[model samples]
Target: MAVRVSTDTFEAEVKNGGKAVIADFYSDSCVPCKRLSPVLAEIEEEQGDRVKLVKININFDGALAEKYGVMSVPTLIFFKDGEEISRLNGAVKKSEIVSEIDKI
Candidate 1:
């Protein structure tokens, strides 16, 4: 499962530090976000130590959403060494996500 984070811990946990992270910015009412959740979980399970998965609720963390310029839900951002390296927006397939992770 993806680790849920709030704005308070986002900078400490995900920004400019730690291992590679896949940050999912989403809203509770979004259908695409719901659909992508399982796919992210599967990626986390498969990658294990290679990466970390984080789920950020836009409604709960508006500041983070604004910081990332998340105009839409289900925005998947990839971070390496605390810097954003890549991103995937919307309900993407498992292969596509894996491809991005592989690049990192």
Candidate 2:
């Protein structure tokens, strides 16, 4: 399962994590976010050893979203070694997400 993160926990959970981190910036009211949740969970289950999945609710953590330049919901930020390597916006396919994960 993807862990919920707020501005206070963002750095500790994502920036300081050892494995590749997928920071999902989403909103509870977003349909795309709802659709992406299960996909992310599946990915987390399959790649638990290689990745750390964390979710930042944009509605609650607007500051964190602003800091990351997230203009919309369901944005995925991929980090490796505490730095952002890539990102995906909107509803993305599982293959696309997995491909990006494989690269990092």
Candidate 3:
């Protein structure tokens, strides 16, 4: 399962973690966010050892969203070695996400 991150935990869980991180910025009422959840879960299940998945709820973590410059729901920010490497906005396919992960 993806870890739910808040501003308090974001740095430790994402930036300092010893794996590639996928920070999923989403809103509770977003339809596309709902659709993207399972796809992310599958990727997490398959790549648990290689990558780390974390979720930030835009409604609750608005500051964190703004800090990351997330302007939309379902924005996936890929991080490696404490820096963002790539981002995908919207409901992306599992294959597409995997391809991005592969780059890190």
Candidate 4:
């Protein structure tokens, strides 16, 4: 399973990790978020050592959503060295997300 984070763990896992990070900013009510959940889980299981999957519930942790300008559900943000590199603004395929991260 992906490492699910809340407002409390955001900074430690993302800002201080000093590695590439992929965060899924979503809400419980968003269907697309649910749809993307399994895909992310699979990716975590398959490539856990290479990339860290961080799942954040927007409703509970609005700080990151607002900070990242997440206006929609199933937003995927990729960051390296605590800085954002790219953002996918909707439910996306696993291959697509992986391809984007590979470039980073």
Q: What is the number of backbone collisions in each predicted candidate, taken in the order shown? A: 2, 0, 0, 0
Give the Cα RMSD of candidate 4.
Answer: 1.3
Best by lDDT: 3
lDDT of 2 by residue, 1-104 (tens): 78899988888888664799999999999999999999999999999999999999988999999998999889999999879999999999999999999999
Clashes of 1: 2
TM-score of each: 0.93, 0.97, 0.97, 0.91
The positional error of residue 29 in candidate 3, measured at the CA in angstroms, is 0.3
lDDT of 1: 0.88
Candidates ranked, most accurate by TM-score first? 3, 2, 1, 4
Question: On lDDT, who's better, 2 or 4?
Answer: 2
lDDT of model number 3? 0.94
lDDT at residue 43 of model 3 (Cα atoms) = 96
Which stretches of model 1 miss by more than 4 angstroms?
Answer: 15-18
lDDT of 3 by residue, 6-35 (tens): 999999998775899999999989999999
Candidate 3 off by > 4 Å: none
lDDT of 1 at 11: 71
Considering lDDT, which of the candidate structures 1 and 4 is the better prediction for this target? 1
Report how far residue 78 has shifted in candidate 3, in Å: 0.4
| Cα lDDT of model 1 by residue, 1-104, tens digit | 67789988887778644568999999999999999998888889999678888889999899998998888989999999888999999999999999999999
Candidate 4 lDDT tens digits, 42-99? 8878877777889999888899899889888889999888788998988888889889
Angstrom error of the Cα, residue 31, model 1: value is 0.5
For model 1, the run of ten residues with the poorest summed lDDT: 10-19
